[model samples]
Target chain A: MALEKQSRAAFWVTVLPPTLWIAVFFLIPLGIVWAYSFGHNEGLTGVAITGTFDNYIRAFDPLYLQIFGKSIAVAGLTTLLCLIIGFPVALAIVFANEKMRPLLLLLVMLPFWTNLLIRTYALIAVLRTEGFANWTLAWFWNQGSTLAALVGLQPFPAYQPLELLYNNFAVVVGLVYVHLPFMVLPLYAALDRLDKSLMEASLDLGAGHLRTLFSIVVPLALPGIVSGVIITFVPALGAYLTPDLLGGTDSQMIANVIERQFKRANDWPFGAALSFLLMYATFAAIALRAYLTRGQPADGHGI
Target chain B: MDQLAQRTQDAAAHKPIISFRNIVKRFGSMTAVDNVSLDIMPGEFFALLGPSGCGKTTLLRMLAGFEVPTEGSVLIDGQDMGETPPNKRPVNMVFQSYAVFPHMNVADNVAYGLKIDGLPKDEIKARVQEALDLVQLGPLAARKPDQLSGGQRQRVALARALIKRPKVLLLDEPLSALDAKLREAMRFELSQLQQKVGITFIMVTHDQDEALAIASRIAVMHKGAIAQLGTPSDLYEFPASRFVADFIGSVNMFEGTLIKDGADEAVIACPDLAPYSVHLPHSAPGSAGASVWVAIRPEKLNLHKNASEPPAVPDCPPAHNVARGEIKEISYLGDSSIFHVQLSSGQLLRVSRPNRSRYEQEHFGWGDTVWVSWAGSSPVVLLS
Candidate 1:
């Protein structure tokens, strides 16, 4: 009896740290968010802790709804663009000849070795008005004017250089570039596992190349594609860095709004409520993805 | 069943389906398939038998259109297959690994080719059902590949390839994945299935027993070349070279230099055995000075009491081919007995005899003195 008691005590002792850590760090914070979602914020000074539905009601207002919709659209576009550009690159790396594959894979992962913010900043130097592209365009325009005077008609109209900095397009490009390797790595892993004979079998059965890709390759690779999308989409939905640096005032996302409420706006209760809403939205998207692919193997959980 | 059998009989009367002309395939620095030529008659069961890396699978793949020949042309029904892709070719293959789609159920797997060819829905369903029934997998049509046994999956692969009703069906080691007992049973079933379907079935396998059992003609390949191509009995009874004789089955070989050649007989003085004369189909007088290996199957030799006493025998044996040896060991398997004997010149010869009821009464144990001898026509002369 004494030995049994000592063994039971040892089991709990071993399990206590991780159990307490999860309860303290995850469950407690979630409970606090749940509590704050029901509470009302007082003006400026503090929040008067009381149960209310006003915060959720305000969250669904046109202003906030528009931001939420825009966030979804932007994140969806980013994910689609990443998939389009990443899949073929991943395929090339995976199917390259033995000696070249390691070098190609290294090139794909090289961008991730540096700080992500530094990489995004590097793009600013290339796309800005005073950058290399604009300088080349200016040089071409001057040459065209001189040639027009010599033999051609009037020179083309003087063009103001492209204004790409601090725009939603830049934000989208940045999101795709930053999140591309995440998408490609998973896709490479999945495509590498696919049987080469299956492709041969499809070709042997009278399906042409395009037909085989759509019918056999695409459907079989749906798991990997979905994983890549989730990996890019979920983080992109709550992204703040790219938008803060590249987007205009009108292009601010829900995550930027939440950040503003916590640090700049100083609305702790409202920020907590917004954070809970973001968490719920992410969870809902995951649940819906699971529900759609219910019976597929390895489909339920999002990466 | 009767209707299916009748259809198979009707299909068997068809003419030559596929032919090959000097096909060659190379991979970078290695020649996977050397220049090869063959013709596959309609509804014939043909086999390509060889060890691993012997280009048998490459040849099979070339016929399936998964691989294109580096040199010569392949024709299906006299149609040039050079420009034809695998799907357009009237051929289908059962892959070596049984490449059944894991996500698909048995019916869908069998129906894949029909659907890909844009068959009508009703026709696809009917054909899939027919194929499932043909392979005796009708009851498991709804189960996925992982849910079935290895043999069942192999049947599904076979059914999938056969349902296309192509002019030719290629199978690459279809029975290699099964256990010994199941492989034996499936070999008989596959042979019967081919006869029933009456498609030109070409299979590649390393197992000699499988080739001998199912093939109407077997092509033994070695080092990217066809060593011998003939009926199984022709190969077993009269192998053309030392490689074929040594590879096909268990045979006792004696190395010797040919000494004398006549119109019907040639004498070889073995360096390690008694000089013996062997009957030849034709005069090989110039081949006397060349080194040769004489081969005799273990079952052909008979055991006698004394070496010198057998100057004549009542069995109407051929003249001049006889050897005497002492039995060194006896191996008693249930249905037969194998005797390992040592000749006076220290060459060992193995002799196998059926364990008949009368023979069982006279058992030869280890360390027995016995004469091993065979008629002149029994041993095959191999020059390589």
Candidate 2:
């Protein structure tokens, strides 16, 4: 690209800082990790450069592969749920009048103002056993039991607090809650730019509202849907905090296993290999999104 | 039979296909349409002509069931459409943007309405082709909307709406997006297409020329109410109000007072006509000594070389309804010439003459003394 602005020298002046920063802080560390993936771990915090495939072969063990499969399924489910819930929210925002539109959009993005760690903690308060979910249910059950006793009927059984936290369900819920904005922003961008007359034309042609939503609105929003699915799925696949904080022992994902390899297991080479695999999978998701949107320009999904 | 006779025959023969009764639409404090009562006959190409913000499109949308009127009921074939949605209503619209689905090809777009109704596959296929062929777009069915030209896209929209066999077809500013040359071509195409389909076509357009060229009857709307509704010739030659008269075409107006109101004729006395009084056919809706304005089209006024030479009327003097003026400016359009003459009373009047042959007529130049004249029936006096 030609930098034909106020000055040719301004190109280097503005670009050099970010390039140097990425090179020094990001790409260089990533390159070191990549180099360590092939090395053999020597004794006492030293890794010798041996260039062996032992770490990669070990990564395909049934245990690691099972974790990988479970991670994929969880990420897929999370992305699907986000899309199912986000599409309507995006549509609502797009159809809202001018005065209410920006305010509704702000509500969708308000969660990001607080840190993700705090928001995940807040969710834990809502979903945990003896938390708000169980407390509310217990209150309803008590009221029903009291009404039954007063009406000359057998009293209901004792109330039991349901287990909602520390399970696969909580992990999925947490991931969906975190990544919903990723799905909604792109959809809102696409749906807002749509020409409303197309919907009117479809209705005027004798198609009802549901038929027009499928035939006209959904197909036109395909690119944004694909973008949202890819971004949300990739991030949820590599999520560490959500699964670690909310998942049960049987629901450990590939990310938690990679973290164990780095910390408790103290296997640096294996951890590096596992993290690289996760990075490659992320790359694959982005590449698929690019292939889907080949002829169209990659639009900015600003929240 | 003549056009007006056929229209009268149609009215006497059948009930109106679509009727709008006392339609009033308001958004908050702003009234968009105020008590509009109109009936569209079967197979008539009726047009709503107005300037922008005059609520023409809003009226069309109400008929198509897109906008619900605040105080009216729309009817189709004597059936009251009180709560009918657009999909249930037997009307389709061709949008101003020509909202052909970008994701679908021309064939799919044309087949959309039939497919939604769940017709048989073979029948849908056959009908889609026929509709495309009607718009002369048979070969381009496989192309998407983006691949088509503006006129071709518009034709695709037409075919898509027509395949439904709706009782009434609505068009909103159909040709306003095309270039001038393409618009002229499509004007004939749309009128011919309407005749072929034999469906009642209600079109909303701000262009007076387009409405006059195609519509059997035109409603001129102003400020949320119709100013006049009449046949094209009636609207052109004898507009009911000064707004209608000034809007349709260019005309010269002179303030006058009605000197005499005879049975079929009235004499107008004006300061602009220092030596002559106007002998109009008494069209100003007022009595004697009432202030009025005399309107004459530029082409209706005649020019003569000398002040004493009378115009086309027999046995009439030149100065009777004629005034002497000097040619202030001359504008030469390709086929005709417009002369801006300054009368002896210092009132400016435009006189247009057709250039019948090459270099043969009495051409008036700047600062030339000329006498401008018009027959008694040429001018329509207005109250405004």
Candidate 3:
């Protein structure tokens, strides 16, 4: 009985540190947010717990609703783009020869060595007007005209730069660029563990490359896909930095609105409420992902 | 009369279902399969038997269109398969892992190939039902592959491959994943299923017993080349080389030299035991004075306490074919007991005796002096 008691004490000793850390850092801060969401605000600075639903009601306002919808759209589009671009990169790394695989994975993760803010700024240099994109376009346009004169056709007109930066498109581009490795690493891990024999069996069973890719590879890699979407989508939903630097007035997401509430408008309760709203949505996505991938085996377990 | 004549002529002109012509596969500096040629007959259950890295699986994969030969060609039904993709080939394979699709249930897995062929919905449903019933998995068609046991998953793989009814079916170590009892059961099931379906099956396996039990003909491969190919009994009893003789089953080998190479019999002189005489299997491949190894099966050698036992050869002395040994160990298998006897020449010879009687006439225990002997036809001469 004394030994059993000692083992129980040992178990709690091992578990105490991380539990205390989470309780202090995460649960306590969240409780503060939840309590503040129900409180009434004093003039400019003070807060008191009157327990009203007024802040939540204001969260459903048409202006805020529009911001939420736009945030969802931007996050959804960014996730879709990441999946589209990152899946092929992951597959290439998985299927590459042994000597080249490490180099390719290193390149995928190399972006993380630098600060994301610096990377977003670097994208600005390439995406702004009269930047590298338009210069390349102008060079191609000049070449088209030169070739047109050489062929004795009509001469083409000069090029003008496309409006490429400071919009929703720029925000999505920045988000996708920043979070692509997040999408790829999980997918690469899942695909690397997949049995190559299953792919061969698919082909031997008369599935073409495209059909096999859709039916076998994607479904077998569903857990990774779910986690990749979660990793990319949740952050993209609550994104503040990319939209702040790359977005204009029309392209502001909910994070920008929440930022205005706290730092600019000095409405801390409303900002906390909006922050909880985003957290609730992310929680729902995580729960749905858990429910969907509950029984999925990480390694390919079947034919 | 006309129908019979035409049928006989057609049988005479029947071509092989698959053929490998001077095939060679090389990976960088290493040759995986070297100058291999073979023809698989229609409806014949063939096996490629070898140790790991002997290129048996490489040969099987080349036939499945997973690997193309570096030199020469592969022909299926007399058509060149060099440029054909795996999905376009008229062959299906059951992988060693049984490669069941994890996402789909059993019925969907069985119906996959037919669905890809754009078959009508009812036909596919009926075929899937039939295939599942064939594997006796009709009741569990809705269960996922992970939910099934190892044996059930293997049956699902079989059902899926057989549903397509391809010209050839390739199995790569299909029974290696099952437990011992399940492997034996599946071996019987595989042989019976092959006979029932009448589709050509070419299996690659390292288990010699499995190949012997299921295959109509076996090809024993060594280092990317076929060392011997024959029926199981021929390979077991009249093995052409030392490798085949030792690989197929346990044998007592005596290093010897051919003393007399005659048309009717060949005599081998060994320092251990007695001079061995083997009834030559027509046209044995060696000359007089050539070094050879004499291999004799354990069951062929009879153990006795004395040389005065009756019904023995009266023309030759018993010492010419007998050796004196002391029993060192006894292994009591249920059906038979094997005795490891140490000869006076320091050779350990294994002798298997059946436990035919509940009360034996005599019991031979360890440290008993015994005489081990065989007839002239029992030993096979291996030249390699």
Candidate 4:
């Protein structure tokens, strides 16, 4: 702070650009949406600031509340899945050879290079009824039936495709696929900063690799794990495209409901209210993270 | 008295606790440790002393089951540790960084090994208390490692490793991280703790003072091999090679040719001491006309400004131990002063004198002509 005070020009040069960018691009629009949440729709394109509580009251109704609850469940499950899968991926990346570490990290981040829509569509191509997944299952089934017939046993019946798309399971699969990099990158950052001699010390003290992983690695990585959970959970909770493209009748989340209010129903005020409620939940998760990492100077990586 | 005699006899007949038999370690194209063979006796405070990359730490790591020797085998307590992992080995290490678990408190850190052994909760708790009290850290058992001072954290590491009571305890540059004053204090503490535990402690250190002060035996490593292995005095006084002599402390190397190899004594004629020779009290190595080095420590030589002082030996006249030089320069250390004496042949020799007489009327300063002499046994001959 003293250095910044002395070099005021450099301080402003560094601080002004980011402050202006956030004010113009984020805060102003968010302020407008916040105002809209307190008002009601006046016409097809207009909203009046009457300070009405009707939109929030309507959001509390059981129908929308059920959607919010289901969204929370799906997002929680997705975050858990991402943690389970990303930990080994991050550990593998950390332990890779110097020449291969960057390449493996590049592979982890490759999915973000292309557009999300394109990737979702590609997932759809593989998960549809007559898609590549069913085709591979059918091929294996035919081979098994042929082998059964050659062994003089009755062959199996006709192959049936497993339901892989347009369900809550598909929504969760898509969210885990999309948000996995967020979890892995932060975990990699945290684990990479860990003092490796602690692991050696544990091993020298007669702990096996598995015990060391659970006792030493996991506790030390709590900050990263919590940050990764929040990053994955918040985005998965507000996911709109994955459910819209792949969800069934009963699989719609709160984001899908909010999208409908703004477009097909032409109710901007209620949509803004629901969006702010989701933001509030995100703020709560972030607050919880701040509380947990209060005194720890070793922050999560990539958070 | 009889029991003490019997105990000594038993110790003499006992087998070595740790032995490295011709061990060689290669990291890709680089050989880190090369055919290093040494034996550490039971309950000995052994030290592997060397500079960085001298393979001292590598050898200790191999003993701890952290690295596998590429060529030879390691045996601890007569058991071949070929397939043993670190956890199954009978040795534990206090890491150089004192790698205490940051997430766990001191008591929990000390209890980690006991928990791994599946001891009951009560036993683990009791042992943790015992270990912490052993290090005089029982009061701070609830504090985290980050909250402790550097010396306290090192004590924590010591307790954590010692709780397991492994047959051998390995320390890798243990005091290298502490401040000089703290390091000196910890040196005695570590030595006392090792004796109290009565475990065979194998420590790797680059600091010669720490090795000399704490270790019962020191192995001076040079270029992936043990240059000399003996007690600290043997290494300091009777250095086997010029490397050991130069590495352990400051020494003056007077190059000369062996002029006479006799039965009771040998003499080396140096051009720097044209009128005097280096007389070895014992018959030394080397034939006539062969070049050899006479290494003498600075503190071993006595600097005198007057010619009336008594000689070191009567009738012998300290022959070949005396040299005539003018005091060229004086470096005034706090406790002692070093006199750089320029010989008649222009060779420089340094002699250190203690600041003993505070009330002396006169002192030897620069440009004072003096005779530097030592005992006949003060010089060590190095063949290489």
Top model by lDDT, which number? 4
**DockQ, structure candidate 1:** 0.39
Interface RMSD of 2: 4.6
Candidate 3 residue pairs that clash: A303-B99, A303-B100, A303-B101
Better of 1 and 4 by lDDT: 4
Model 3, position A270, has a per-residue lDDT of 85
**What's the TM for model 3?**
0.92
lDDT per residue (tens digit) for residues A1-303 in model 1: 999999999999999999999999999988887787777667776677688877778888998889989999999999999999988888788779989988988888999999978987887876688876677887898888888878868876786788777889888988898899889988887777778787788788778888877776666777788788888899999999889987777789999998998788887677778888888888887887677557776731211
Tens digit of per-residue lDDT, candidate 3, span B287-375: 98898888999888788874444225434444455677899999999788999999777989999899999897988998998878777
Residue A268, candidate 4: C-alpha displacement in angstroms = 0.4
Model 3: chain B TM-score relative to the native chain B:
0.92
lDDT by residue for model 2 (B30-69), tens: 9999999888898889999999999899999987888899
Q: What is the lDDT of residue B201 in candidate 1?
A: 92
- Of candidates 4 and 2, the better by DockQ: 4
Clashing pairs in 1: none
Q: How well does model 2 score by local distance difference test?
A: 0.89
Q: Which residue pairs clash within candidate 4?
A: none
Question: Which segments of model 3 are wrong by more than 4 Å?
Answer: A1-13, A149-156, A294-303, B1-13, B274-285, B306-318
- Among all windows of 10 consecutive residues in model 3 chain B, the one with the lowest summed lDDT is B275-284
DockQ measured for candidate 4 = 0.53
What TM-score against the true fold does each predicted structure earn? 0.86, 0.93, 0.92, 0.93
Which candidate order results from sorting by DockQ in descending order?
3, 4, 2, 1
Worst 10 residues of 2 chain A by lDDT: A294-303
Per-candidate DockQ values are 0.39, 0.52, 0.62, 0.53
Q: Cα miss at B129, model 1 (Å)?
A: 3.5
Worst 10 residues of 2 chain B by lDDT: B310-319
